[model samples]
Target: MNYLWPILILISLLFSIFRGTIQDINNSIFTSISDVVTLSLTLVGNMCLWCGLMKIVQETSIIKFLNKLLNPILKWLYPDSKENKEAMKAISINTISNFLGIGNAATPAGLKAMEELEKENMNKSELSNSMIMLIVLNTTSIQLIPTTVIAIRASLGSPNPSQIIIPIWISTIVGTLTGILITKILLRRRKI
Candidate 1:
C-alpha cells in the first residue's frame, strides 16, 4: 500500500516535470517553503506560550483537579483500564494538548497512552475498547482554541484572526460528538 503511494507520487512528479512548466513548479516550491517557515515560527511561538500555561496548571495541582473531575468520564471511556494511572495521565495530557491546539504535542502522548494500554492487555492482537475510544477521540478532538488557524490568519494579515474562535469551537464540538457517536454505533454493529 505504501509502495503504491510512492510510485504514484513519482509518476505524477515525472509527468509534471516533463509536461508542466518548470518555472511554475519552482515558484510553488519557493512559496511553499516560505509559508512553511512562517507557519512553523508562529506555531512554535503559540505552543511555547501554551506549554508554559500547561506547566503552571500542572504545578498548581490544576491538572490533578482536572483529572479528578474527569475521572468519571475517563472511567466510562476506559472501563477496561480503570486501574492504569500512567495510561490515564497520558490520555489526559493528549486531550489537554488537543484542547490547547497543539496537535504535534498530542501525538506522542497518545502513542504513549496506547503503549501503556497495550501492556495491560492480555490479547496482543485484539484492540481494547479503551484503545478504540482513544482513537476516535483523538481523530475528532475538540479544540478550545484554534491556535494554528489563528496563527495562519495572522500571518496572512487578517484583520480579525481571533474572530474564528466561536465558529471553530462549534465545528470542533460537532465534529467530536459525531465521531464519538459513529464510532460507538460501528463498534456495536461489529459486536453483533
Candidate 2:
C-alpha cells in the first residue's frame, strides 16, 4: 500500500511533465498541501474541544449511561463481542467520536476495537461478521454536529458556518442507515 502511493505519485509527475504541465502540478501540490495543513489544524482544534467534552461526559457518568442505553443496539451490532468489555468501550468511544464529528479522534478507538475483535476470533485470519458491521458503521457513521465541516467553513470565511448543520445531520443519518441496510443484505446473501 505504501509503495503504491509513491509509484502513483511518480506516474502522475511523469505524466504532468510529459504534458508540459509541471507548473500546474507544482501549484496544485502546494495548494493541496496548504489545504491539508489548514484542515488538519482546524480538525485538531475541534477534536480537542470534543475530546474535552467526552472526558467531562465520562467523568459525569454520561458515557456510562449512554453505554447502558445503547446496550441492546450494541448487542445486535456485535453479538460476538458480548464477553469483551474493552472492545465495547472502544466501540462506544468510536461512536461518541463519530457523533461529535471528530473523525481523527475516532480512528485510534476504531483500530483498538478491530484489534480486540481480531483477538476474539477463532479463525484468526478471517474477520467476523461483527467486525464487518463495525467497519460499515464507522465508514458511514452518523454525525450530529459536524464540527469538522463547520470548522472548514469558518476557516474558509463562510458567512454562516452553522448553516450546514441541518443538511449534514440529514445526510449523515440517511447515509448511515443505507450503509447498515446494505451491509446486512450482503451479509445475509453471503450466508446462503
Candidate 3:
C-alpha cells in the first residue's frame, strides 16, 4: 500500500510526459502542491480553533461529566483500565474529541490514552484487546460534527456545508458500533 501510491503517481507523471504534455504535467504537479499548501493552511486554522475549544473543555467540569458517561463503555472494553483513571481520562478526551469530529484535536488525547494503556499491557510484545479496540475507535472515529469536512466545504465555498452533519453522525455511529462489535466478537473467539 505504501509503495502503491508513489508508483501510481510516478506512472501517471511518466505517461503524461511521454504524451508530450510535460508542461501540463508540471503545471498539474505544482497546482497539486499549491492546493496541498492551501488545504493545510485552511485546516490549521480549524484545527487550532477546535484544539483550543477542546482544551477549555478539558479544563472545565464538562470533561469529568463526559468521563462519567463514557466510563462504563471504556471499562467494558478495557477491563484492566477500569481502575486506571489516567487512562480513562485520556480515553474520555480522545473519544469526545473524535465524537465532535475534531480529529486533529483527538490525536493528543488518543496518544496519551495509548501510552497509559501501554503501561498496563503486561506483555510488551503483544497488543491487548483494549489496544486493538482503541486503534479501531481512532481509525474509524465516530464523528458527530465532522468540523474538518465542514471547514473544507466552507473553504471551497459551499453554502450548506453543515448539511452533512446528520449524515456524518449517522455513518460514524454505525461504523464505530460495528467496529466495536466485531472486535468484541473476535476477542471472544480468541479466548476460546
lDDT of each: 0.81, 0.82, 0.83
TM-score of each: 0.67, 0.68, 0.67
Ranking by TM-score: 2, 1, 3
* Model 2: lDDT of residue 46: 68
Cα lDDT tens digits for candidate 2, 124-150: 767788799999999888887877779
lDDT of 1 at 62: 67
Provide backbone clash counts, one per model. Answer: 0, 0, 0
The best candidate in terms of lDDT:
3
Number of the candidate with higher lDDT, 1 or 3: 3
Off by over 4 Å in 1: 1-63
Top TM-score prediction, candidate number: 2
Superposed Cα deviation of residue 103, candidate 1 (Å): 2.3
Error of 3 at 131 (Å): 0.8
Between 2 and 3, whose lDDT is larger? 3
